[model samples]
Target chain A: MDVRHLSLPELREVIRRGQYTGPTPGLAPGYAQANVVILPQKYAFDFLLFCFRNPKPCPLLDVTDVGSPVPRMVAPEADLRTDVPRYRIWENGVLKAEVTDIRDYWRDDLVGFLLGCSFTFEAALLEAGIPVRHIEEGCNVPMFVTNRPCTPAGVFHGPMVVSMRPIPQEQVVRAVQVTSRFPAVHGAPVHIGDPEALGIRDLAKPDFGDPVTIRPGEVPVFWACGVTPQAVAMSAKPEFMITHAPGHMFITDPKDEELAVL
Target chain B: MDVRHLSLPELREVIRRGQYTGPTPGLAPGYAQANVVILPQKYAFDFLLFCFRNPKPCPLLDVTDVGSPVPRMVAPEADLRTDVPRYRIWENGVLKAEVTDIRDYWRDDLVGFLLGCSFTFEAALLEAGIPVRHIEEGCNVPMFVTNRPCTPAGVFHGPMVVSMRPIPQEQVVRAVQVTSRFPAVHGAPVHIGDPEALGIRDLAKPDFGDPVTIRPGEVPVFWACGVTPQAVAMSAKPEFMITHAPGHMFITDPKDEELAVL
Candidate 1:
């Protein structure tokens, strides 16, 4: 099956039936893929406020109507329960299950939030001749927990997590220029060259994801990661929550260009 | 006193003390002024969602803690009750009173919202050499209600209200380019050239504010106005509401450049 040529809806429909469950790095090439966060109706206001307060870490793309699995703005007909390739169920902040669909766990009070992911900007960077080490190394991007505390909202507060890439000394400015266009995603690098300033003690070992090799002329650049909200959720220990499993995101109809500034 | 050279807190202090009641056009010079909206907690979520849905019309800058009267993020020391030069009170969609302070009406459940005002972009436009007709005419910008309905959120639903400015044909592109930088304020032109496209019947007679002269070679450019939330609040007619009267706005500490995307 030549999935590369398939349309967005066609690709999602295939995932909904439990036939496909894997990383969605290159699928649906030009469309935006979003990080998913669903919480009970009681927590909706705080979660939404949290995203508003910290736009860099959590750039909200679309929010589903309360109790409705459909994200009307991003994907009107797509069902959140089944359309996503994989979902992680969390109970009181503990990961309880990793499954293909959350139909059985669905409740009427759940509110889903789709946040912008980094895939769009990474593509732009690659197109501009900047090398992405994770994609080249065939490993997950190196992620670390920073000491910088996110501006807290009601019942949600924690330090930020950042993804690191070693950019060549000269391409650092170009990398910043490229990523700054997509503030809907993680935006530009939060820290460059100095890990200790972010309370990161080691570059070789990250708290999450695999660490990539740093070439001779490269300097470490860090960006606010999407894992921030999840880490905050874990710390808060909300009664119930659901999220898209790592790299298995929800694809939206809007193109990456729609989110760009220039 | 030279109010233009006065600091933000000092200007706000003057307003708080009832020493100033005039429109704040050039006051506090480079600082961002905000459109104030105070609604009961019962309506905050839907109202915020409404703002989220219609970003151009209602670009939110800061939201105060419920009943706090303190906008922590924007100006930690500024008090909402007395900082704005003038305020309009509405009860069940009807204009009730105009007040300098609302200490008597203060409620434990009220939520104050600070929305981006066009002063930020207008400053940018003037700096970029684009002539703003209303400013040149020394009159309030003309505003019209459109046939297009805003994406409704709960009980808040109404047509978009746009503020019009006649721009020279040569400067239209520059106007768009200049304003596009400040998305926190009403970003870019929603419509240009034809008023009929937005269902605006006559340019001379606006639903709100004074009409300006459109030169022979000028095109009528419309922007999503900050008046939208006020119009919608009137339509929804909740138990009680409060807003800054016409041209009297609350000023924030951040400069015009702080709100810019680039």
Candidate 2:
């Protein structure tokens, strides 16, 4: 079945019923896919501040009401506990379990945050005729941890994590233009030419995801990644944390076009 | 003395000393002036979420650490308790007092939020040769409560409030182009023409501030006002709320240019 033809509610229903358990990329093609983070109410203020302080990496889409499972803005009918394809439960910042649903782990103090994901911008790039090397290579995008420190908010603080894409020198301008329109999703390139400028030693071996080929005429472009928040949360070693595992994302009802301002 | 020539810290210090206790419209010409809202920590999450959910009326410039008096992002060395020229204290949603400084009222649970004010974009309008009628009239800009409802978060919810300016029909496009650059401030007009469209019955009488004349060949253009949050907070009837009295604003160290993009 072509999931692209499905509406957001229909797609969410499939994921909820455990019928679809795949990476949400290219699914519900026009809808925005969000990065998920759930934390106790005690940490809500600091985490919200962290997102506000570091909008590039943590562009907040919608935050659920404290102790509520529904994302009133992004997906009113959707349940945060079961709507995502997969969940990674973290205890004291360490991954403890991976599950299809977090119903058993649900708590009254949990506050869910849905952050804008780069998949929306990637679609924009493809539409603009800019090549996304990782898609062509059929692998996850290359990600690296930079020496740049995110502005701290209470207990959340760590190095910024960035995703790299090789774009032809001429097309670099177009890539920046396309991505800048989607500020909700890690907008624009953080660095254009040099990896070492961000304190990254090697491009061939990324800290996360698969490394894509860097062609002769192309330069590496880096964008702030959603992973930065998850990584930062882990490093803080919070008493508890919950995140969407890797490629598995929470599909939001907001259309990709809704995110584009211009 | 040309207030524009004075640096931000110097102007803030002057305000702190009660030597500059007037409207801040023309003061510190190129620096950003902010609308201040200080609330207790208990309501901080809901209020922050309210600002996020309603960006136009409440474009947050900076939020101080919970219980901290300093606005670290926009005015790191400045003290929120003493920087603003005037403050209105609300107890149980009723205006209890107006004072030059809030030093005596400071509390450990207080959180100060600096919201972007239209002064920055008004500067942009003047630069583009668009007339700001209120500035010319030497009175406060007329503000109206729109029928439009802001996205509610917890207990903070209310109709959006907007400030109106009369512009020549020919300059409406230029006005939008100028204001669009400062989204941190209320970016662009929420309503371009026809007061009836916003359910505002009379242009001669405004809900707040003084009304300026709308001349021939000119239309009323409205931009989201920073006052919306204060109005909403008052309506919610929080146990306590503190805000900058109208006209007297919290001057930040950031230049107006720093808030602009592209």
> Compared with the real two-chain complex, what DockQ does model 1 have?
0.53
* Per-candidate count of clashing residue pairs (backbone under 3 Å): 0, 0
Per model, kept true contacts as a fraction are 0.10, 0.35
lDDT of 1 by residue, A6-81 (tens): 7898899889998788878799999999999999978887778788888888888888777889888888889999
Residues B1-262 of candidate 1 have per-residue lDDT tens digits of 4577777878888889988887888898899999999999888877887888888999999887678898888889888999998999999989999998877788998989999999899999999999888888888899999988898877999999999999999999999999989889999888998889989899999999998999899999999999998889778998899999988999998998999988
Candidate 2 stretches greater than 4 Å from native: A1-5, B1-5
What would the C-alpha RMSD of candidate 2 be, to one decimal place?
A: 1.8
For candidate 2 chain B, which ten residues in a row score worst on lDDT?
B1-10
lDDT of 2 by residue, B1-262 (tens): 3455676778888888877667787777788999999999999999999999888999999998888999888988899988898999999899999999898999999999999999999988988888999889988899999999999998999999999999999999989888887889988789899899999999999999998999999989999998899988889898988999988999888989899854
Which parts of model 1 are misplaced by more than 4 Å?
A1-5, B1-5
* Candidate 2 CA-lDDT value: 0.90
Computed on alpha carbons, the lDDT of every model, listed in order, comes to 0.89, 0.90
Which pairs clash in model 1? none
How high is each candidate's TM-score?
0.96, 0.96
